[model samples]
Target: MRRSLPVDAAPPVAVGRGEAYENMRCDVCGSGERDEELLLCDGCDRGRHIFCLRPIAARVPTGPWFCPACAPRSKPVKRFPMTQTKIIDFFRIQKGAEDVEAEKCGIFQDVKKRRKRPLVMHKKRRRILPYVPTEDKVQRLKQMASLATAMTSATMKFSNELTYMPGMAGRSSNQARLEEGGMQILPKEDKETIELCRTMQKRGECPPLLVVFDSREGFTVQADADIKDMTFIAEYTGDVDFLENRVNDDCDSIMTLLLTEDPSKRLVICPDKRGNISRFINGINNHTLDGKKKQNIKCVRYDIDGESHVLLVACRDIACGEKLYYDYNGYEHEYPTHHFI
Candidate 1:
């Protein structure tokens, strides 16, 4: 017979064998080892049901395995609560009303001193025109002259005065003679244009002229005369035949006047061939370091005598000799600067 085992020679306690001694329940499913197959965590000896494993191991892991909580690689995320003092410091709340009152008083004193000084109007500065290559300038001038000639020819051919006489199917004899002779009697001056011109003459200034110059991006409009903000820059008046035919997203150079919200009532104005100084007003895209916009003008639609007109209104005080700009995309903040020049 074998000798009796010594008291210290008894086997060490078997981990997760029975609930009587180990009393181990799965951390995941709360099932004891006697009720189901369990994996005892090698690190903390916590029980986890075999079926409750996230990936459901086919068999016990070859080596020692840990329960989800006791895994060496698992980390618990810690979050700290925001305190009232932290918020106050972030917002820089003032602690004293006396400091604020003193600051206000200083501002008031500065304003009073400024009011006592003699009022002096700021002199308008001169805008430096961009230099263009001689060849490019000549080509552009030739193109402009050609376009003007074509426009003049078309105006003479379809003279507005040459209308059908009473009980006649064709133009009046005098109109026919004027057309056949190729004589273009200048149409009566537009009252609006004439009145604006007179106003400029009274101010000892001539009407502003459009000058195209090569800039960093491309050719752009520059005014020869200083134009005041909110003043009538120029008027674009023409027959419906002169408007653009195609309406689409690709056409940014054209301004479409929405007579009504309905698409059928929309009027598209294309100033590509003919327009006033307003056409030269570029869209605002460049911004200051703080994202402040430099746009000083806006396009407003006006209805006069059953016709639609686009007027450039001064949105803010524009300095003289500054480049004119407006929000072309309507929404100033959401404009796609990449699409603009």
Candidate 2:
């Protein structure tokens, strides 16, 4: 009295050195039916339904078929630790690598013709500068297009700065709310560095950065050039919304913007609809012993122009090709990062 499901014709088996059918069950659907429809990953040795793939492979792959999670990725992030005193100094904008001599920093050895003046920030609005790729025009266009495509998966539009959404306090009107939450105003040097990044965009320059897709970590940012410690990496930007409104929000990347005495008045940054490169950064695993060691970037919140703004700053010197990572839940530990590497 039961009808059987129609099975597609058996396709050619792939030549892979994976484990011989441990359970022969589809890891995605937990189905044992149609043994021909399952393909074991060469790396993880897990079976996946052919139809469960994004592109839906017609037949078994030629050599290896690694699942999305098991694919080999390159994002060798540094494991530098920032001391508590240094973090307090960062909040106050006390000292930075901009004060050191670039030539003597030993980051780039080819800086013999540069001037000795310290990098000074200007007074301007915060913005995300366009990344100028050190490649030909065609390649630049390709990289830009690739970046756009990578971020557009969630229907996100490229934004250089934060967008004020409805139900959120106006930017300039949030001073009292932020102050009520023990938030301090952004210091002058830190404020100017933000403008410097925005100004650099106007001059067709940017902080040397690159975005790469990793299997285990998803999309991650890497330094395109040698960078000094305490450099402003980028701002964690998106639509600003009140915490009370987004309590049940399904967004996974929402960052806490402001925490107030009243739990209902807190603000969170949601980068789902619009965002910048900061949206792609991965978080550190604070639950493990090696967690703090993997974070090279620091996520700090400051009241900029009476509005809560989050900035990612480098805690130590970063070499080119090194991936960037920060603590999602710093000392407060709001979010869970046990699953993260």
Candidate 3:
């Protein structure tokens, strides 16, 4: 079902740049035309036009109106899990591929000629080569539980990181994207942040982060210490698949991966089955008061070697105990926040 649109086909919806409208628009219909009838949700503060509501209302309510999902005592009706493995077998991972770790860590061009080396060949780095995870068993389990909780509402298997199923892109094929002009090498500035993250992952050094359950947001990630701006937090790991195929996919945590000029080559990351803390990080309802301020973590994409990796970086200095939030729709404003957790 998922395949890229032909080049001559109708234009697709914009994916990035989720900018809200100038006037408060209806969250249900995504329109600002009917100004007077639009009512703001008391809970999330998103506007909803009266006509968009079921059984169309004649006039706006008095004071403190809430959406159906945000109504008092209203409960979330969770749906069946989208765990069918057979439905995603349209793509296949390239065979005899390079190991994934090397693809993630390696980004150097081969040197044809060698220069004379100094007697002391040692090099220096700001952070250690590999990050070491805390040895505490309780903390490790806590991290695992956070990942597990991402899909707990729908009953899904837990994954600490992204997993490549048989039909997903293989390391070698992903690496070939550079030659095909579909991806670029991580810039020097971008490389530093990602390298730090990789070192932490290599040494199993867990970030000073934790996943905590929020009655309103299901599960959310938080900073355990004061984190600096541009500090790499975690990569959005998941099953990489074509976007066209997932048009009807029931997974809620799917993220856009690579969007190339060629419509047939679009890719998306489905984290329902396997992902880390990034999967648990909730999206900001931009219509709320904290919608803009609540986003402490900025999601960034990088092309390391030939593979694409999505990283969650702090947009600014984060104090201890602050929860993390980001714009799920990037800049497009397409992803909806209609269903409250």
Best-performing candidate as measured by TM-score: 2
Segments in model 3 whose C-alpha atoms lie over 4 Å from true places? 1-162, 168-184, 188-193, 338-341
Q: What's each prediction's TM-score?
A: 0.36, 0.60, 0.55
Alpha carbon lDDT of residue 340, candidate 3? 29
lDDT computed for candidate 1: 0.41
Q: Write the per-residue lDDT of candidate 2 for residues 192-219, one digit (tens) a residue.
A: 5576565443332335776776655666
Ranking by TM-score: 2, 3, 1
Q: How do the residues 1-341 of candidate 1 rate in per-residue lDDT, one tens digit apiece?
A: 01112234654366765454357676776756443356666666666665566534323443446666667764322221234343223223335435534543554475468569886799743221111112343333332333223333222121111123343222112221222212222112222333433333222222343334333322344333344555444444222321223432233355544333333433444444344344445665544422226676666554333334455555654453555567666622433443233
Of the two candidates 1 and 3, the one with more favorable TM-score, higher being better, is 3
User: For all the candidates, what are their Cα RMSDs to the real structure?
Assistant: 32.1, 14.8, 12.6
Go through the candidates in order and give each one's C-alpha lDDT.
0.41, 0.62, 0.58
Given candidate 1, what's the lDDT at residue 164? 30
Model 2 TM-score on a 0 to 1 scale: 0.60
lDDT of 3 by residue, 23-69 (tens): 67787778887565577675665777765765344345433467787
Worst 10 residues of 1 by lDDT: 126-135
Angstrom error of the Cα, residue 205, model 2: value is: 2.2
TM-score of 3: 0.55
Ranking by lDDT: 2, 3, 1
